[model samples]
Target: MFEALARFAVRFRWLIVVAWVAGVAGAVVGLPSLSSVIQTNNAQFLSASAPSRQAADLAAPFQGASPAATAIIVASRTDGPLTAADDAAFSRVLLAAATITDVTSVRDQGTSADGQAHRALIVTVPNGPGNAPNARLVTAVRDTFAAASAPAGLTFHLTGPLAQTADADTASTQTGDNIRKFTLLFVIVLLFVVYRSLLAPLVTLIPPVLALLLAGPVIGQAGQAGLPVSPAIQQLLVVLLLGAGTDYGLFLVFRMREEIRRGRQPREALIAAMGRVGESITFSAITVIAALACLAAASFGLYRGLGPGLAIALAVMLLAALTLLPALLAIAGRALFWPTRPAAGQQSIGMWGRIAAGAIRRPIPVLVAGVLLFGGLTAGLNGFTTSGFTSSSPATASDSAAGSAVVAIHFPSPTSNGEILLFRFADPVWHNPDALQQAHQRLLTAAPVSALTGPLNPNGTTITAADITRLYASLGPTGSLPPTPPAGITPSLYQTYRATAQFISPDGRTARFDAIPAAGPAGSRAAIDAIPTLRTTVADIATAVAATDSGVAGVDATAYDIYTTSTNDLARLIPIVLLVIAILLAVLLRSLIAPIYLIVTVGLSYLAALGFASIVFVHHGHSDGLNFIIPILLFIFAMALGEDYNILLMARVREEAHRYPLHEALTRAVARTGGTITAAGLILAGTFTVLAIAGNNTQAHQLGYTVAFAVVLDTFFVRTLLVPASAVLLGRYNWWPSTLSRTRTTDTPPTSPQHGPPSPPHARRARL
Candidate 1:
């Protein structure tokens, strides 16, 4: 099968190249916009099973009037402490903003205690087209306020839920673009360095570029086919295709060059090279695809979408590597090695042969050294903390950070990082105001709450519980209260009475309030840790009040659920990926023993990489902790892509072992393939290094660096040293239960009592 494909590619090189180019161009021109698919994917990051999704469903109706929809604008006074002029400007702006659609309630939260800042709140209807709020609406509000004239010496900032989402999205998009651009540039330079010929690098790069162009459209179409696709898949595709495709190119090209030096012409050499190495590349791509497919079992919609989307990308790359890359190599031929052309003769087994000889001769020392090195790095796991995944807030460099600072200044209440708490009952609580007050009092004492805001504490201070009942009587029946204040009631008091309609449902069966966690912002490590305890207290309050249903919603609750789901996914998905890849290894190598140890080496490599990342990004670096997704991503890429080298190296070893004794075969195999693995590892590592440098965001940097470091470790250490040494120690059992294992004996084997005979005279002559 491999020889057939190679022959067709060599015979029809021009046609293959043109067809691939046209196919990629078609995908680029005709497919759905990448951004549209990303937006759709972003809206579904949480599955329907998540508590946040359920909470959003339960409180959908109350969302319109909820203060949780509110935005805050802080007008900082530069000339002096804020005065009446700032207040007047604040009121004028507040009224103008109120006219904006979905702006439910606009209030001057008023001057800060320090008297240096003034704040006004603008509340919009929280519900948008999908799961998230309308971030575009925040842009509109922000632009309106920025366009409006403010008091002299006042600088203003617009910030709230949707504003935050908008800012974060902007920063992420910019950084993602930078990563793609830099990765492309870096890969070109790296390939040029690796090949030394100008045209050679370009020829090598065409396959991966074509694969990348085609992947986006395939993923978009997959989304249309009802496959879950993550918005983040596009960012990751750049890393995988460029890295893996180039590795495949180097695999075939290096061997082709060697064959050319061994007296074969360009076309014949490439065909021969493909015949030898094609199976390795095929199995490598299949291993990565299988590993990624395991993510389909994840409970988090984020991971579930990521699995098949990435798998689709690898599949496209596999096709290009197998077909287009072979054609390019066939055409480029000996001229592809222009600056350092090889003359026709047999190639030498030089540097790697000597190194491999030492490993086979002194396997114990090499194996022990590899183990100690990896073990030392893995000890960095001591600092690993599963605090949570990344947050939607922009980085410190973004405008959102400026807005948060303003919030910290003027809106310095304990509830600054709070959640929206809601309770539903079969009966209305307005008539039974005491039950409402009782629930509130219990939350303050029993829950993690530092403060609570609801109908009973409308102005952030207590209002008598009995007055709530009396006030409802004066305001008339449910949903019938006059918009205007009646006689004997103050206008401010009337607004409070009207607000009760918002805090408690107009139908009067449900109530919503705000509760500030004692720990801090929902994304903060401490706050994330405290959510389980808070939920238990909420349940206690639910049972005591006899509420039919209740929930804690907003950022904190959603983050807690996401973290829990990711934790479970890591636990479940890791074993599934390991089993699937182990099976693939077993079938490819025809050895159960080889599969077990191969998987162990890969696991060790992954864990060491993950721990090293924690040391870089968490323990010593400025980041609070490793992003929860980074470990899972690091593990997948390390284990899957790392196996590419494993397969290539081991397959060569097995082939050589068929023709020679075990120790000599291992040594020769390493010498022949070592240069290829080194070049491939360097190119793959370069792409990820560009990712690390250009990622710009904390989580992106962590992921990029971790994977790059892992590739380097596997290239210089595990693949070069650990795997070969362990293989020598395992001996013939490496191909257990297969004909190779039954018939192929080691050079020095006599452990079995029945196997102690000398060879016949003809057999001895055949060995010579």
Candidate 2:
């Protein structure tokens, strides 16, 4: 198949070149008019179907040109009561905000107990689905607030989801721009260094650039077809394409050069190179694509969105490497290696040659040394901790740091917080006006509830509206509210609240109860821990609600559904991905033992990557921990990438083993292939290192460093030392029962006699 492809590309190289140029130009011309829809993972910002989409749907009925913008109002004072003058000034500021063009409704303005501090209002601004936040309106509000003076000794703080989102968007854009600039510069320099020729590096970089340009249209079309594309996909695509794409290009070029050195014409060399390396490239690409595709198993829209996009990018780069690259090489001919010809009669001998020869001489010692080194690094895995998504943002940044400061001062922890809770009742009995009023009063007195609305229905059952008002409410005039709720409602009411809190079916048989912790929304260890308690509370409420009538079913009984589902998903999906990768490796290499060792090495590399990142970003970097997705993502990249190296090195070893005995073959194979693998590894690693330059979030930084470190370690240590050492020790067993052999056959070139090259100078001197 690769031979046929090479033939077509060499036969019609110009057509391939023209097609690429046209496609890239067309995409560039078309992508600019594209929509700039800023999406986020926040459930409140999307609909229930997908977190962002569901949030949008829920906010639809609020009546606006756009969804309302959320705002937090904080009132603080030194000593006196919050006077009428202060209230009037604050109200005027909010009222002035309503006059802005996109302004729709402002809700929930009120004073707190003791009158020393209060929450005056929440500002809701009109926003369309997928629209950028109304920054103009927010600016106007800020200006209005700044212009208004509070009563003497009073101060106010204003912020909310909209404000934070707007700030994040601006920061992310700036950070992305900076990242791109630095990444481009770094790639140029790094590639130049590796290839040692400006033209070769330029040629090497083209496929990745082409892959990225093509990916944009593909992703856009997928989005149009209703596939979710996360906001982060664009940035990730750059890293993914450059990392994998460069590796593919390097493999093809290295093999082509080797073929050229073996007395083949340029066209014949290109075809031979593709024929030899194409299968391995395809296998490696498939493994990576499959690994990324596994992310679709996640319930979270974020993962689902990224999975297919990354898969598509990998497939595209693979296709280009197989087809477009050969065509380009055919056209360039030997010029692909311009300014530096292969040295006359000289051969490349890499570190692997020395290591492999030493290992074969002392296999046990080498094997033991490798085990100790890997084991020592693996020990760091014990310190690993899962990080929250929001924690990816730099804590020192204005929005993130300021937000953290506010939460620490006014609440418990950020992760333990909930923004919105919806409830349903099982029976019409509690929907009665009086019963509903009682339920509302009960909710108001519940431990987690800060404010409760008047009952809207007249049944014995109804959904209660409780705002986690304390989240936005300021410190009391004296500083901090008592931890416990004041006594008023009965134990039955508390029990009923808990029972009805579960997200129950619409039938009067189920009820839902919800609580907003003092912290903000999203995942955290604290959030994970608090969920069971919240579920228990809801169960208690459901039991009480059920007592009202035999027909009543506690509908809202599953408050921990999202958390439980996500955790269960991670456990199930991770193993499946690993198993699938192992199977692919086993099949491609045709060796069970080799696959096992390769998988283990890759796994250890992944663990080391994660451990190193955690230490740098969490224990030392002062992040709470590595992001929850970091470990899984590292697994996919590391395993897939590690497989790329494995295939390259193992394929060379198999080829060499066919011509020589086990020990000599291992040494010669490592010598010939090590330089190519090292160059490929360096280029791929350099591409991923660009992520650390992304300043908008810590996740990118951690991901960049983790992947780069893993690639470097895999190339230098695992591939060079561990892999060759094991191959030597395994001997003929490495190929299993395959008919292929390590012993030289009649068809093989002579090892010591007169095949082609002249005898050494020492032999000539002896003859003289």
Candidate 3:
């Protein structure tokens, strides 16, 4: 089948090349920009049934107060309590800030209790679903603050949801060009070094570049059809195409060179090479694609989004590796390796032949050493922990994080983040308004909740919830109170009553309040984990208030849902990924035992990589713990990519074992494919290292480093030392349940690998 495909590709080489070029051009000109579709808000990525989303639905009428695009400007006098003059500067800044485009309103929330700070709310209509408007508004607000005159001690910090998103967006955008340039540059240099030719690297690079260009728009279309596109996902596609896709190119190219050296002309060599390694490359890509496609089963919207887009990318890469790559090689011919030409006749497999022979001879000790080394690393899993979605200090620092710190000191809330608590009763709550107090009191003492503010305590002090109904009856509706205080109502009491309207629905059946979460960053793992207990408290509060419904909504609530869903996604989907990959291996190798042990080796590599990363990021690094997303990503990439090498080496082993003795075939296979796999691993690892240095956040660092390390470990240790030794020990069982197992192999490879004369395959027998 591969031989037929190779013939078609080479026969229609120009047509294939032209079609790939046109496809890339069409994607660039016709499709939506990848950035245009990137998801901005975390909550937007949640399922409609998520608790925070449900809370958002119940609070829809209060959207005016709970604007999606909102920020807080915290003004404080660093040296001491804020004075009247400092307050005047804040007033000016607010007035100037209110003039920014998309800004709906700006209102002072009043001074802090200690008089050291003040916060003002800036609300804006979301111009679009992403960060462009938010970033523009943030910049305008910062400029407004910068242009203001105040005491040198006076400072203004723009913090909260809007500012944080913009800062993160900007950080990711800054790293985009570097991720591409360094990834490409690294791959070219590595290929050039390995092939020892000027043109070979360029020829090898075309498929990955074309794959990268075409995959983005395809994923964006998937986003249009209803998945989420993130800047990180786009960047990951670039790295994956260059790193993993190019590996298939190396496999075919190296094999073609070997075929040419065995007396096949350029066209014939290309055909023979593609025919031989095509199944290996095909299975290698399928392994990656299968693992990624399994992400669709994940309940987390982010993982669901990731699974499809990345799977599409791997598919594009596979098609290019199998079709366009060989076509390009077919056109370029032997000149692709200019300045060096293949010496005709069978040649030695060099140093790796001796190493393979030694490991094959001492299979027991070699396998034991490999297991013990990785086993020690696997134990580092004990140190593994989670830091949650976002950390206070990420690899990419933002001004908003710094501002939040100052805001914490100025306005010492018990919780670092706040949640919106909503209650709806069977009847109008104004009729038995004291239930508002019952709910508020219950929440104030709740361990993970504090500083409850609602209809009963609007302005940080208790008020009669009935006074709210009475004031509205006397003045106006809950949302529209009299412009001024009338007879007998003191100004402070009138102000409190006006503040109370937002908490109580006009119909009076529902109520809303700001329930400050317990003291920790909203994105912390502990904060996410604490959500279940907090929800229990809310349920208990609902029962005490006798309300029909209750829930908490905010960043913490959304993060909790995503965190739990991601974990569930792994447990439910990982087994499916393994089963699918094992099935592919069994079909490719035609042996059930091979798939079982192969998956076991890949699993060990996955754990060792993650364990080492845990030691670096969780145990020793500045991180509170490794980000929760790292382990899942490591497993998929390692299992899939680790199998890439496994498939290639095993395919070569199976091919050679057809004619040579089992031990000789094992040596020849390792010696033959060693350099290509090594070069492939280096190129793949270098691209990931580029991401670790160039990506925008700490999670990227952990993810990049872990995958890169796994690739290297697979290249040098598992594929080279462990698998070969184990194969030698297994003997004929390596091909059990297949015709290859029963075949008697008398012939062997050349003995003096570096200097032996080429011998006919059926007649030669090699001695170790």
Candidate 4:
């Protein structure tokens, strides 16, 4: 079937090229803008059932009037203490902040204890990381503060949730672009080095480039259609298409070159190459798509969209490999490998060939040694820990980082990245002293709250009806405070009451508090690890106190949810991928037993890869550990891609076994497919390795290094040695329950190396 398609491609190569051009153009024209749909808010994508989401939903009504984004402004002096002039300048800066468009409110918290810095919170409505309003507000706040005519050596800095998120968005974009550029450079250089022919490298480059052009827009459009796509997922999509597409393209080209070197006509070589490797490529693509598609079962929205999004792009890459790539091969003919020709009937016994011959001859020893090697590596798994999603990148290196440093020095509480709890009561807590005191005491269970602020009265332990009466009277009976407090009320008391109003809903039933966890930053494992206990304790207390509702909402909660969801996804998806791929292999090979061992070796390869990654990143490279998502993502790619080579080689072995003994078939299959499989693995691994160039992007670096190393194991050890060795040891039983296993043990003379059709070659003398 593939032969006929290849023949048609050779005859209609131009038409195929034109079709791809048209397809790319159409993709460009129809691609929807994803920016509007792109979501940077990780919390927004959480399942509705998540505690954070539930809390957000409950708080929506009360939060309707709250600022969409808030900025923490810190003003510092180089001189000893802030002078009267500096204080006056800060007041002017605050006044300027309130006058900016979209500015909802600006409040000066107080001067730092050192008296060199003062802090304030600039709140603005309708603001977000990506929106123009937020961007303008952020810029306006910085500019307005910098414009303050303070004494010499004074400086202004902005650092808060809004500023950090905006900076993160910018950094992510820059890093992703850097990764792409580095990947392209790596592809071009590595292909040239491997192929040794400039023309071959160029031909090798086309398919993946086309795959990106064709798949990127579709994926973006899918994201725009409300499919849950995250920045992390989008980056992975590009890397997957390029790496896998190139691997497929290289596999076919190498096979075709081998056929051509044996002296077949270029057209016949193309047909034969397609007929020989096409099924393996098809199966490979399907396995990958199936593995990724398993992510759909993930309860996390991040995984739900990631699965389908990557699958769609991979399917496009597979289509191009089968159709567009084949046409290119047909059009280029022998010229694709121009300047690099093989002498007629002369075969090259490369490193892979030597390894294959060694394994085929010493099956049991090789198999045992390989297993032991992988087992030793797998031991590292015991020490492995997931590096939870966290940003160690300090803003944009200079201004952003410097500003953050200033904030940390003057206003350390904001820098804690702690927890925020939203509490809703049957009545205004400030109007019920008992409920208010009980709630505060309940929160004390999760003690060491370094800082706590909410709607309660002074000392944060009580609220009395008299206090409420004073609050309203001091505020002129309206929600807004008067220019001066009513008779008998102090200015400090009125200011405190006005500030407390920000945390309470007008309906008097909901309130919010910012609490600093003593553990650490929300991204820290300690912080996330505390969430369940904290939530349970908080919930129990809330119930005991009769608070209408209570839930934790913050970075800490989100991190905990992500960690839990990822663990759940790994547990669920791994078995499904294995079962599905094992079934696919069984059908493809038409043998039940062969699929089982193939899967076993694939799993071993993944473990070996992970072990190696942990050693490099944790023990040696000084990284925290593998990224939390690495194990699952690596498992899917390694198993699916590792099977790619197994199926390729074993299917050929199955074909040869029809004509020769099982042992002889194994030897011949290894000899024939060794180069192509190794090359394909190398290309794929190299592409992922290039992701290490993503500066400060630990997730990218972790994935890049892990996948690259894992693919090497898949390509060199598992595909080349372990699999074939296991097959040779199994002998006829390798094809269990099949008629062929019962049929033959005769010594047959294998076909000599020559320009002939796809047939088994005699076991050659080991080059080693």
Best candidate (score: TM-score): 3
Q: Candidate 3, after superposition: displacement of residue 144 in Å?
A: 9.2
| Cα lDDT tens digits for candidate 4, 347-441 | 64445545666787788898889889999998877768786454334456745566767756654353235576777788765566576666665
The C-alpha local distance difference test score for the whole of candidate 2 amounts to 0.60
Task: Enumerate clash totals for all models, in the order shown.
Answer: 0, 61, 0, 0
Predicted structure with the largest lDDT when compared to the true one: 3
Instruction: State TM-scores per candidate.
Output: 0.87, 0.75, 0.88, 0.87
Candidate 4, residue 366: Cα displacement in angstroms equals 1.6
Of candidate 4, the 10-residue stretch with the lowest lDDT total is 746-755
Per-residue lDDT over 1-768 for candidate 3, one digit per residue giving the tens place of the 0 to 100 score: 998999999999999999999999999899866665666565666778888888887775555443457778888876787877887788889889988887877755555545677677687887554456578889999998888887788888887777877777776766777899989988988888999998889888999899988988888777777777665686788788899877988999899998888788999999999889999999999889889888888777777788778989989999999899989999999998899998677564777878888888788999889899999899888946766553223222566777788667755343235677888888877677678778877787889875666777655545686786687667776444432467899866775676565577667777887776675656666677788888888888898889999888876787787777777887888899999999999899988778877888888888898889888887787577777777788888889998999999999888777666778777888888899889999988889999998887776788889889998998898888889887877777888889887775623333543323235554645421
Q: How does residue 419 of candidate 1 score in lDDT?
A: 72
Displacement of residue 587 (Cα, Å) in model 3 is 1.1
Candidate 3: residue 749 lDDT (0-100): 32
Clashing residue pairs in candidate 4, if any?
Answer: none
lDDT (tens digit, per residue) of candidate 2 on 1-768: 989999999998989988987887897677531124434433332224433233233333221223236555555554766677776776777667667665655543233323454443344654532325455555666777677776677666555555555655566667666766676677778777766765766777787778788877777666656556655676777777777777787788877877766667778988998888888889889998998899888776566667777898888888788778888888888887877775324355655577667666776786688777767766666766665544123335554345435433432221113323323344432333333444445554666444322222111123343311122122211112221223763433332232221222223222222334422233445544454444444345545544332111011112233334445667777888888888887777676777777888777777777777766777777776776566667788888889888987787777656555566666776777787788888877876787776645766777788889999989887888777677766776777646553333312332422222222446645633
Ranking of all predicted structures according to lDDT, beginning with the best and ending with the worst: 3, 1, 4, 2
Q: Between the candidate structures 3 and 4, which one is better when assessed by TM-score?
A: 3
